[model samples]
Target: MSASISVIIPIYNGEQDLPGLIETLRSQTYPASCVEYLLVDNNSRDRTAEMLIAASEEMATQGITLRPLTEANIQSSYAARNTGIRAANSEILVFTDADCRPQPDWLTLLIEPFAKENIGLVAGEVVALPSQNLLEKYADCKDVLSQKHTINHPFCAYGQTANLAVRRQAFEQVGLFRPYLTTGGDADMCWRILQGTDWEIEFVPRAIVRHRHRATLEELRSQWKRYGCSNRYLHELHGVDLQRELKGKESLRRLARWVLKELPINTLKVATGKGSAVELLQTPLDLFSFNARTIGQREAKLPEKAKEIDRL
Candidate 1:
């Protein structure tokens, strides 16, 4: 028999994005009778709650169970996910963000690896949605949200929750995501599962989710800053070594080189219309991301207590 699945999404003021996700879910090729949608509202001040209620009513008749859950007290997406995880009624718990649109076969292919008893988690691919905006295009050029990036992490292979699926048993063994963690919970959970159990992580590239990239420069900076914060938390909890950005002299030398050489070359390329300006934007955008993360690491508050995995 096919495993039952629960799609858990964390929504925070997602009034604009939820409807599109609902349509995608409605069109899923997976058997609707075997799947449920748990849309967790993270105490949104917007119309997220109202939208979810309406979605629930709309999806009910289509044989897909849509539930509106609230994680009102905790202001973390991980916490909201935990609420959905606990409330989920299936053997497989699939996670995605509100700003993603899963392709029709996403759920089907994502859980396909579960047929292997040793597979603990399935990480689907995340591609930026089609965009004409320069910043969003830059994210696409870098494949910023690709599962391959995290799946090949130096410390350990993990998957972003943007397109991850975990078996209930594996989750049970490793416990739930750290409710207090605003970031890095996904990586932490994967590491714990790999170290604590015999199960393995699998990548499903065909299971794709079209994600909305950060549209503005500020949003882009904030994204990388949060990532830097995650890096710090992971280092504190698991002792993952800091990357080269913290090696003061090496970092300074690299910055000096960029300022002296690459910057002017790229600027000239854009000015002369030599090549794709979007391609040239990669280096500077990367630098911008790097600095944002570095600042985030420095500004991050270390957890006062040792990392403890939260469980039901």
Candidate 2:
């Protein structure tokens, strides 16, 4: 049976990359009649809304349906996604980021797994775009977006929203993404779909999207810090043990060692052209990410600390 698909993308300050994403979507192998494109603008101060509006008009002339929706009340991407889900007209709700560029057959392959009866979600692969610098190269070789690794460990399984699809019924059954969360919402959704029902999530490696990694150290640190904040929220919601997972002291120790010893050694090796550039770059980045995540987790817990002080 052929399935109709609604591709939903949540955008915020993505005007520069939106055109390329739209162009790639236009080139998809899936039939235009069976696919719908929904772009949700999350109150961008930039021209993302204008760009999407213009693209929609142009796409309509080509017999493609492109709808622009806005979720201005909330700033979270999950909230925007929920808006898209409610407005979607198809049985399969596919999600990808505005910064990601899908291959021509990405949609075709992503939806193919839905042909099976028990499959409720499809997690597609996300590959880093061609790296033009050391920071990008470090991200390219990292295990950041490996859905297969996550799926194999169901307890921690999470599909990156950048390349994921969910059946409409499964979403209805499991419920919408938590509106309060700005990050880790994809992981939260995957956990609920698996734990709340009998539905299975299949990983489709061939359904690929090229993602742009952070090109600078500051951007990379900011990204990890966001993840850290999300981690704290997830722990509170799920009653997961933060002390067990975070091991704050251990992280601090590692950060110290990396900053004091490994960083200098790697830097010297790189300077001498004896060390791998990716390794040299990745070590400090990883250390910074760890410390930043720890800090975020600590920050998220402050509200609880305030409550405790009030009780005292």
- Candidate with maximal TM-score: 1
Lowest lDDT sum, 10 consecutive residues, model 1, at: 301-310
* Tens digits of per-residue lDDT for model 1, 1-312: 677999999999999998798999999999988999999999999999999998899789777899999999888898899999999999899999998999999999999999999998999999888989999988888888899999899888999999999999998888999888878999999999998899899999999999989999999999988988888899988999865564557567767777888778877888888856675666667778888889888888866632656696
Tens digits of lDDT, candidate 2, 61-134: 99999999999987778888988999999989999999899999999999888889899889999888886788
User: Candidate 2: misplaced stretches above 4 Å?
Assistant: 153-156, 241-275, 301-312
After superposition on all C-alphas, the RMSD of every candidate to the true structure, in Å, is: 2.1, 5.3
Displacement of residue 224 (Cα, Å) in model 1 is: 1.2
Worst 10 residues of 2 by lDDT: 303-312
Error of 1 at 210 (Å): 1.0
RMSD from true fold, candidate 1:
2.1
